[model samples]
Target: MTDAAPQGRLRARSLGVAAGALPTGPLNAITDVDGVLVGHATVDDGADLHTGVTAVVPPRLGLPAAVHTGNGYGKLVGSTQVDELGVLESPIVLTATLSVFRAADAVLTYLMRLRPDGLSFNPLVGETNDGFLSDIRRRPITEQHVLDALEGACGGLPAEGCVGAGTGTTALGYKAGIGTSSRRLVADGAPVTVGALVQANFGGVLTVQGTPMPVEEVLPGVRHEEPPGNSCMIVVATDARLDARRLGRLARRAIFAMGRVGASYAHGSGDYAIAFTTAPPQRPPLPDDRLDPVFAAVMDAVEESLLNSLFTATTTTGVHGHTSHAVPYDRLPIRPGTGG
Candidate 1:
């Protein structure tokens, strides 16, 4: 039980907000990357259950994808293939830790229906522990839930905070959840959009663009460590064409952005980021020098995406009456009460 947030959901640049130089797309979300779709299945039994699944669908199956292990410390299934082959065959699913295997199974089942005659497939899955507000032992997620997310996926600015895999998640002692942001860049005279989506469930002194928030002051007596060695699942999407090797380089920048927003990268934290693009080769081969603008866009978008997760999240009560309070918008340096 915490005081109501003074303002409604808003991104960092809403009220006199200025964090990045590049302009954002119309939606300012991962879906800003054409053909990239996102969907969520939130489970809120109106009781202790507050977990769900989030599915991200690329333009097509088997696209270039890569992951950067910022702090390898949790269950990330199908990562080895993505590391070795540098491609993804199935949609990416995000869920609770224990449900990762089940989520992957659900993905495979769906893929078989799409291609029954195929022999091999890889389902990219990532997770963040949401035990703070949900009974993790119950493993509330189901294959149908996974399927629903995938089937319902669509291209647009995704719903953020306290939905999808971010439900029941805690970050920087606040009730953090799903968030997204995007940046537009002109690469080789073509408009390139770099968008970021985040499951904000990790810890540290919460910072927004280098300014830290007084968590204890805003949410007095809030527990700073209930979630226990939490993790974050960050997904970056762009229209810039790059293979796995280059994608890996772009993926690491998302982690750097996480740090700027106050991720401690704890010993038990499983901080991971995956980067992909829907762009096709417009020329024989693109040089590495052209990636500089894309990298800068990724960094800013990821940073703002994390802050959006925190700002949009409202106070949530959970298992055993343990409440994860939302970060007070008034505590932020920028003026509140506006939307992006």
Candidate 2:
């Protein structure tokens, strides 16, 4: 909950950023976006068996917003209205792939039980595949877990790596889980905030900046065999003034950042990005407004967020006796320009 003085170089467990180039907002996290809160429900039991849920709530005081990006590589429940009509009427939820149905149902139940005024609630939920370590087939996630994540949500520094839904995930052949980053942008003479949160379950060879360093290089004897059917669900939130169409374009740019970090969108990997804007609601009859500045902010934030996720993740062990090592802080290649 504290904003440590900005460092000359910010070094995360797995990734590092140049010290003074890009300005990091307070907390340097998705929560930097005002009113955005993140919470995790982690379930870890000794070795291997680990699972949990994460929740991202945008302004608990019922702020109206809209979702624009609608990719199909993975499942994002409650995006239909966001895409069709350009509005998000609920908090966004994230959990394991198999738990989407239960999570969504639980969210609905919470909303109705709390409101009780016949108000409709469309909950946003994103998922990533984590079957390699956990018994995904068993559907271990329950409705209560979803509720716990929701109820426990708060604003502050989010706990990363081996926590929540990221507990059993892997990224680029190494242990990976939830990663988040944020950036501040000034467009059209006003300051705007954009933030990104990711469920790191994608498969790729480890690479930094464009250096192709396969997982085997760092973790000797490891083979590039087919990874578990894994996928990543990235949720981006911003307060910039942008319409749904512009937001969709910004969401697509997140893939570019993913690729920069060495993800290939493999046939078995499900890579998806969902972006929304909490800019004041422009209800019916409101005059159309231009959103070029918001689009630019989205692109900048998505790129930085992806990098943060990779840097924050630490090595982890999961079910089936598989262990993914963390990126070696000493061995990573650092160029003169980019932070080492």
- lDDT tens readout by residue for model 1, 186-247: 97777789999999899888876578775776677765555785899999988787888888
Model 1: lowest-lDDT 10 consecutive positions? 1-10
Highest TM-score scorer:
1
Worst 10 residues of 2 by lDDT: 1-10
Q: How many Å off is the CA of 75 in candidate 1?
A: 1.1
Clash number for each model: 0, 5
> Scored by Cα lDDT, where does model 1 land?
0.84
